[model samples]
Target chain A: MHKLYMGNRQKAPGQQFITPSSHSVQFYEDPEVFLEQLAGFAGAAVGAGGCYLVLATAEHRCSLQQRLARRAIDLRMAAAGNRFIALDAREVLTTFMVEGWPNRERFFASLEPQLLRARSARLRPDAPLSAFGEMVALLWEDGHREAAVHLEQLWNELLGRHSFSLLCAYPIACFAHDSRDDLFARVCREHTEVMPTEGYTALQSDAERLRLVSTLQQEAAVVRAVVEERERAIAQRRHAEEKLWRSEEFVRRIIESGVDCVMILDPQGRLEYISPSGQQALEISNLSNFLGRSWVEFWKDEDRPRVEAALAAARAGGIGSFQGDCSTPQGTRKFWDERITPVRGNDGQVEQLIAVARDLTELRQAQQIAVQAEKLAAAGRMAATIAHEINNPLEAVTNFIYLARTTPDMPEEAARHLEVADRELTRVAQIAQKTLGFYRDTSKDKWLHVRELVEDVLLIYERKMRNKQITAEVSVDPELRIYFKQGELRQVLSNLLVNAIDACASGGRIWLRAHASTDWSEGGEDGVRFTIADNGAGMSPEVQKRIFVPFFTTKANVGTGIGLWVSKSLLEQHGGSLRFRSRQGSPSGTVMSFFVPGNANLQVHELPRSA
Target chain B: MAFLSRLLAARAPAREAFPSFSDGPPVSAVRRPHVLVVDDETLIADSVAAILNRNGYDAVARYSGLAAIEYLEKKRPDIVVTDVMLPDLDGVHVALTVRKVLPQTRVVLFSGHVSTTQLLELNSAAANSFELLSKPVHPAQLLKALQPAD
Candidate 1:
């Protein structure tokens, strides 16, 4: 009986473990344990007058030879007698490998010679020949896993014909990946005897091994539960993060698309973030230039105090708001209804400030338009009433004048005086008729001669201009005409003329000019352009900037503030525009020019044809 | 010119015999068209009535629309000339009433305010039946309007 040496002085099951024609496999992690087992197997074969062959890596082969030398096997004498043969596993694998696979004929052709020589060198022909090979291990390490398993099968087939005991060894590290577990099972199945690594095989007793196995099983269960809990925690965190990201995206979209400007300021009152709409509202092309700047610095100098107060209030964890004017970088004045609210941290202390600004420029203009319309309506009603009241007495006077002129006996000179008086009264009646006409026929569009419209407006303001001792030099084309809303145009012209008259001092000169011209701005449409220039005290630059702003007036209480604004709005409604130039230096004056298109039929429906 | 001289000659006697119509028939064989001048303003009513008399029409003055309507119940005039805006009744109401009372009598309306034109025009029957004149009405224009349609 042949006994295989186990490292712990334990006997493996099954006698004749290294008998002739036997195949075995060893899976090992520790090289020392593997070399001890190999030394035992090979030493027994040499002592039995048998042959021993080794096909392994250089390191393992060198270590095995040294161990055999220590055993006094006399390897040099054994080699001369054709007993011990050692070869590099990689070199031997190359001789039989055909395109990374072991061809059966090449396998026999490469290893049969070595096997026969070792068998024939045996002390007796029937002596046991034991061979150890790590070639399969090398193939598995090189990642030709199929070749390694095929080579194992070929070795089994070769053992049937040869009388040698074969041993295949693999490093436990070769099956490190979980996917190689099936390959490990297959490799074990290919061998008649399979040896586990030292971890299982080195146990002193079966009871001890069983106890260790039970402990390992319990540890594996605990590890699996811990891993599942960790995975659950990680998944919960990911889900919460995804929800947070989605909510942030929703808020970002709202802030980006909203019309109101939203801004965030640091507790120190410096701007930290501005929404996309805020950047547009502030007319900022580059946010970097405005970031970290004091938020109050954007307002006008006169309004800075109020803005600063609001910011301070919000920084103190209170809400503040104001309606004020601020100019953009492009110097366009804008009105903003801005509210500031404090953003607090968990500690209930102010951490940031949020400012939401609603553009009030358009709203303010709309409100002013409504107020001006109401004022104009009231004025129209009053004028109609006054005209109606005056017409009664005027009619009585005209009747008396007619009767006096029709007297049976009258002197020629007296009759001529009465005739003159009657003609004068007719002029008065014409003025009354024109005043009443302003309120009547409000929705009619008609062609108006430039001279006649001018004369009509001048006639109403003639007394005022005369009282001011202002002289108006009128130059107009007699045939210059415009077809538009009569009352609206009349109102515009009246506003301009009245402004000019009011601006002029006593003995001041006013130039009123009208000509048939083309509105080049609107692609050369035939139109009439009127220029009313006054050699009065011209306006300052500040006043000129806000000239068209509703309720921005320089003429304290007497002026209705929205006169020019209403006029401009009315003209714009008719596809026209009004502009002015003024200077305050010597020979300074203001020249206001406005253009009216000739054909306004297309604009008739766009606006109500009334003042 | 002869009619003017005759009117002038009759003016003094006519002034003394003012508001003294016989209520039966005229002393002259030539029939005069009877005219009713209605106005809240006494001066306007009296002057218009006097002018119509001088123009050879038998005209009477009523200072109120109610007084004019009262006068109409007694005598159906050939024409009713009234101010549109009155203290008691608007001229449209008076004109519509006259159309009901005396279907043959023509009504002429005058108003100092232009709004009355819209008011009259809004009432289709009054707009069609009555001719509106804006005030400070000239004597010739009034007389032309008062003339017989034929």
Candidate 2:
């Protein structure tokens, strides 16, 4: 039985010794030292009358042959005697490989015959048989580490059956990566003897070797600590970058979906970046055209000073805000509530400015409408008070007129004058009643003849028409009637007729037409449509578009501006509509038409009870 | 009925003899319809009463709804024409009192305030019980409204 060399030992120069049936593994860095050891092992076996079998790469085979020749071993005589056998490690690997793993049956089938021949050819039957293999190293290099380890076990199995010693060599560079300490220990555990790399093995004494190993171990510990610290710093930096990206994405999403226009400007008040919503709000399709342009250029001339002041304040690292009116790129007038704030860098210096603008056009319109409605309410109340105060005196005057007209033997001319006075007083009473109609609960609808209603409204405007020398043509069917709130309809007719009379020049003609028709636009309801047309200077297209907009008026001094808007609303309240068409030119005229439903019982209830 | 008859009989001859202003007389032989005209405006009440008197009725004038009610307490009239908006009490309240005091007497309400007239008309029971008229009422319309309903 051969004794096992579990620990590493130093050997004299050129002295080679290996016991039969020994399985040894060497992890090597330099090829020269490995080859020297290989030559010693092969030459000692051949010179001691033992057979040597070599399974190595072609390059190693050539080098081994050269080293054996220099050691004075007759490789040709050894081969002729069948005591030195050489085989390519790759070719030998395929003969026993089964799907990248060593197959025991095939391994023995291919190699046991060669082993038997080498043992029988030994000059003495008791001489040692030694085999060297590099197939496992080739497998390890090819990344088949499990196969290499399995093949090492297979070689040990072969050594148990054959009376030969096996030596396996692997390049130490293959195990240089971290976490490979277990694999290295595992490879060392598989052999009866383990040879360290040449860095340790080449030393001539144990004390020198121990000293080098102690220094290498100390340096390795320092490198391990430093690598761990660097890895931690790299991980922290990556985490911070991910958090920053998430925060940027959150802000980007908010800016993209917000309704307000948001912009970033440079210190010179030039636009640098604008949010997606900002581009849409400003009616801009391409931001490239506006980029680097002065922000104050977007405001109206009147509002430029305010915008510039706000920018200057922001540049001074303070917030500024103002409300101003401007037009968009598409030329839509807008009222904006704008604010500008400075963005500061780590050095506490103003780096950029952020401007936000909120549109307030609709809010301003609502406020104006509320004010107008309150004014109208107050006017109605004043009319009610005046009518109440005047009616009592008017009644007394009518009585006096009646008593005077019936005076005994009064002159015929004086009586006739009193009759006229009585008629005019009746008109005054009618005016008071009409004014009071605005304050009264006139929500109750009544069936009224179209002709009578038309004639009554015409009588109120008769004096104005007569003063202008304007002739009115009336064509209304006396029998045609409508169910409506009388006050609201009278107001609508009065407003339109007044507009028509105002539009007519001296001696201009006004046409008032009423016809029984079906309102196709309003679900085919039967109704009477009245058209009032005048031959006067007509409105422009821009004026026509805003004719029904509240507080939009062409008449600067006299127009209340709410007449057409209120008229339209009044018509719509009873399931009706008002529309007009106008043309400008020498034969210019305006035709304003309105429809009143024949039966508005359902709609009347929806009206407010007060007016 | 007795008080109205006494009022008409006492004022008939004196109204014809004077042809203008007449004091309250004690008694009369001929019967005439007695009318009470109430208005806060004295001219309106006096003129309306004069017109009613000229039109073959014995009429008296009061400048307030409370004064008209005070007059009604002493004597009953065939008709009471009261302005709806008055100083102390509205024509509606006076009419209600007239109905309570003299169930047989007719009540007529007139007002320049259209809203007051509307309120009376919307009061379903009052609308049925009392006749409402808009003011600046012609003397003829007022006389016609004062006429007893068929």
Candidate 3:
């Protein structure tokens, strides 16, 4: 019967070599000696030194030939103490050994005749390639009369290397092959072909063939178990590697997601990691240049020592932070908040340092704005105090002058002088009043007439008007009215009138027009609009732009620069607006318009009339 | 009627009967108290003094806190009103010094631009002993502050 080849070869325990004329007698009782001798013969035929054969019960041929060849090489290597490279029969069959050669013809002649005789013999009534066939081959070879004559014509055709196992049935003639013309062949036959039961006794005789075979089978099983164990170990290692990769990914995502710049440095201060926010914070174009560089190299020279100390302290587990100026392309920057935290490993060693930095540029700017506000508030308080001192006496002086002017039978010259004093006192009173208006806390509103307020403001300009020969034209639409604090509106009008009169040189026209303009400045509101225009030396374009700013004026000594500013402030307090327009040179003049919301009549307080 | 009226007329001054600049009514007797005025600038201090005088409580003018304190030693006013920015010791320190001597006297402090909160730890001894007033004080506002409790 043909020994079935399994999918994988079972490696032999160890190789035992017995060449012709060298150690041939030692294999006389062993069957593995026969297997090794046959393998050597096959190897010698193929011009190689190594071969492995696998035998099973002719049913398990599931593995590919390449897989079998790899199995064969592994088995041979193991038997040879992991030292030998085995030849592949499949490689030789597919390539050079089978291609257009004399060896192929000889090989086919030997195998075809043997295969054909076996088929013809199987046609007879006998177990196919069974022990009966082995007995018939031995009987025919031994000169047994009937068998020899009957098997003569088919004997040469039926001989094959695998069919040599038939001799086991004829235990006597098998000795002829073991002690044959070739000593190596004799030793192989004696070692593997001799049956185990055909010994002197059960225990004391040379009957160890079965036990040795069982030992070799157990060794092959142990080798297969080791291979399976290694495979499980490899799978476990792969799983652990995958877990490590995921953990690294999770940490990377957290660092990248941070909003503040996150940087990690190794214990030696070389940058190990830089988060995405670091690129945005530093405004760098490339992230590669930032990593694996000394942190001190990227820092400005002055900040290096400070950062280094912080890093050292953090690494030592004493918490520390660094605040230093960082120079950036936008400005000399202040990095007022930067923290360094040590990353410790399981062994309690400082593994790395992580730094987080937030930019505080807006915080500094907000502080500066608050400081400026405090200063302006202080200045306003001081101005209010000075205005208070001026207002009291100035009020008394106006009353005194008014009383003096009313005296009966006063001489014309003395009355004129009294009139001049009253006018100057009124002028000084206007100054005090305007100053108070500028500094006073605004509260309530009262109705005021545009025409009457204009007349009262023009009284202060009388001397200037007479000196300059300026044409003073007052045209007020009777319907025009305004709502505001009475004194505040008066101050606003006074500032505008004074500015207009001052803008004029000798013999310039001052036009005061009051009307209700719904279409003031194209798209404004329905309001009482007053325009004061002067044909004076008009302002340049530069001066016009800054005309309403505090402390901005063109007149050498006459303008306080704050008049227009204060005027705008007062007008705005009354829910009104002020605007200016001017022509530069030819027919040059300045025109300013104030638009007051026309809710004035509802807020009127009756003024006391003089008797 | 002739001698009696003459003696009465001699004793009585012009502005008010017993219109005394010296030895006027004790400040404690007056329901609404008067703060004696003291400043070197006569224009400023006298204006304040006149406003206080016209408001119907007595006001004695002095140039400095030391003089005001001397006047106060003779006549115990209900309250001592002084400028924080003074020719003598600063008003805050003067208030501190006055509290050491006359602990009963209520001190009303004034300055041009220094806010009360900025000057005094109001929750502490200052708030308990004194009050702050911002200058330049309007006469009506000052007189109203000086109006005594019932």
Candidate 4:
């Protein structure tokens, strides 16, 4: 049978200076593999009638027992026959140590009993017994290099007398750096045979194994250096990718969450990237609706030229901005304050345009209201001066009327007419004063006298009627009253009166009448109805049909076309209505009537008109 | 014109409606309290002066604050009623001038403008005793303000 020779010399029985049969093997092997190999060596020696001694930790001892059992060797029977001796290396080392240092005599005393029992159990066996020691490995792991070497030397000395083949193992982690090379060389020199690492052990010849191990070790060092550099490169790439993703995510979040419509347009004004807000501002379902579409298509036809000009400016590497009326998907008009800024490429050419559009619809409406208010302010200022001027003359005329009435010999009827004139002039003064305070919108309602309101309107028309030789007649149900906004009611009455006057020809007759009508309010309360009828050229059927429509005028530029429309609107706002009947041509006339509910302006419900 | 005078005569019985002027010197001459009324509009100034004169105060009219101040240099009026906004000097400036020249002179500033209150505030520091009236000035309120104890 071919035997394993792990070292330079084969083991011989009882040599004088050194054990010819003992081979000192220094190996770097896993503890289990070491155990199995140890078991093989130990079991072979025991089978040859040589005693086996093992000094290892209990874990390795059990592993060795299992391996020996797997090899068909009964380690327990061998121990009972005194052919095998197993001891914990730590316990054995404790017995030999004197104050943390190994004592030679103590080391000899500790092992001699185990060694003698193992040897006495066999005839100077056919072959020397094999022993395995891990105490040096334990010492090396504990960072005591000198003590580990001393233990190895002790094992070598024991080899002289015991004639045992020795196997020793240290974990590969024991000498991990170049600084431990001295200790490494000393450990190798102490052994008769130093086994290469696991990689080169399969080689057939020792010289070839040495050469291949040297080459493989050098190649492994180069491969490790290259692998470390590659790992650093991969780490750097991952870090850069993470940073780029974070920056893109940050910008994406800002653009998506922004209040304005942020969009990126190619230099040709085609939409490239439309932010979430852009889709919302344009009322599109998603960016897909706008992406790759011409941005000018979103603008109103009238606004396209301006948008094209803005895009041209932006393409020229300049900023452009415009305010425009744009419609939503539902075709409702909206105003946008849009701006396009050029994004220049490295070549200094316009690469893209960043369009940020803000919805300015409400702002535009408010600005229109401000302009209207400014116009009203100017009109009010003019009215104030005009009222003041009118009041001055009205006062003088009042005083004149007062003096005329105080005349001793004036006709009684003339005096009576002068008194009426005075009262009407006072009303004129009141109306002028009302104009001065036109901005004051009073919420208070008053019990309105319908007849008195009609009389007031008639008084305003008295001069015009007389100039046109027209006859004005009035018939009223006495004390016809309605509760409402008095000023608005007066305006409705004035509108009807003027419309009747316009319908009348020269020398025509007109009648103004009022009475309490049926319940017409939301609460079904009684209302006051007033009627104005004129015998003159009346409205055509079509004219009467569209009379209340705003801007529907028959009198060419002479009429504002808003009087009837406004009168009807105002009446509706006051919880009332204006309706009429008319016949066209000779002997034909128009009868216009309006009703004010008794409880008008008092209800909590909204009026038809917001104002 | 005759009817206007007749109308004035028609109110002869109510001559003592404002008796503050009678509380002054009671000589046989019946020395009336001289009032100076200033307004940019001649209608307002003359009408106010006429109304005051009808009530027994000897009132004169001036169209500008500077004219009122110029008139103040010659004769010391018992009261100066002026418009707050004048084409020349401001009414508050006239009041301050009155306070500087004649501390005893009473001032009444009347205007139909929103800036009247701001103008009054600017002069209220020195002329706190002056009266402010918004136009169009009612004759009764003017008469009552001229009462001695008022």
Question: What are the lDDT figures for the candidates, one per model?
Answer: 0.81, 0.82, 0.55, 0.73
lDDT of 3 by residue, A1-611 (tens): 21111211132312222221111111124333333433433233222332222221112112222343443533333334311223232332223222322143444553344334433433232212311122222333443424322332232233333332112223333444332134323323333233332231133323354565577589768966876687779899998988999899988887787767788889888888767876676776676866788876767787888888888898898766877767553454556567989889999999988888776655765565456557656766666676556644554344334333433455788779978886776566565444443435334565556677777677656777889888899997543456666666777787888888888988888999887666345355566778999998888898988888655678757665677887787778656789888997798999999877665333322222221
Worst 10 residues of 1 chain A by lDDT: A1-10
Sort the candidates on lDDT, descending order: 2, 1, 4, 3
For model 4, what is the error of residue A219's alpha carbon versus the real structure, in angstroms, after optimal superposition? 3.3
RMSD of each: 9.2, 8.3, 20.1, 15.2
Per residue, candidate 1 scores C-alpha lDDT tens digits across B1-150 of 554334333432233223345774454654677999898887677667767776668888898878988999999898999999999988888998999999888889998876786687687654455788988787778878877767
Clashing residue pairs found in predicted model 3:
A4-A56, A4-A58, A30-A191, A31-A192, A134-A166, A178-A186, B32-B148
What does candidate 2's lDDT look like per residue over A52-90, in tens digits? Answer: 999999999999999999999999999999889999999
Error of 4 at A421 (Å): 5.6
Error of 1 at A53 (Å): 14
**What residue runs in model 4 are displaced by over 4 Å at the alpha carbon?**
A1-44, A50-194, A198-221, A262-334, A337-356, A362-611, B1-35, B50-59, B69-80, B92-108, B121-127, B138-150
- Candidate 1, superposed: residue stretches over 4 Å from native: A1-198, A201-210, A247-257, A261-276, A283-318, A322-335, A400-424, A443-459, A462-486, A496-568, A571-611, B1-33, B54-57, B100-104, B124-129, B136-150
Better of 1 and 4 by DockQ: 1
What are the per-residue Cα lDDT tens digits for candidate 1 across A69-169? 89888889888888888989999898889899998999999999999999889897656688999999999999899889999999998898976778889
DockQ winner between 1 and 2, please give it. Answer: 2
Error of 1 at B76 (Å): 3.0
Q: Which stretches of candidate 2 lie over 4 Å from their true place?
A: A1-224, A285-289, A293-312, A442-459, A469-492, A505-538, A566-579, A585-588, A591-611, B1-30, B125-129
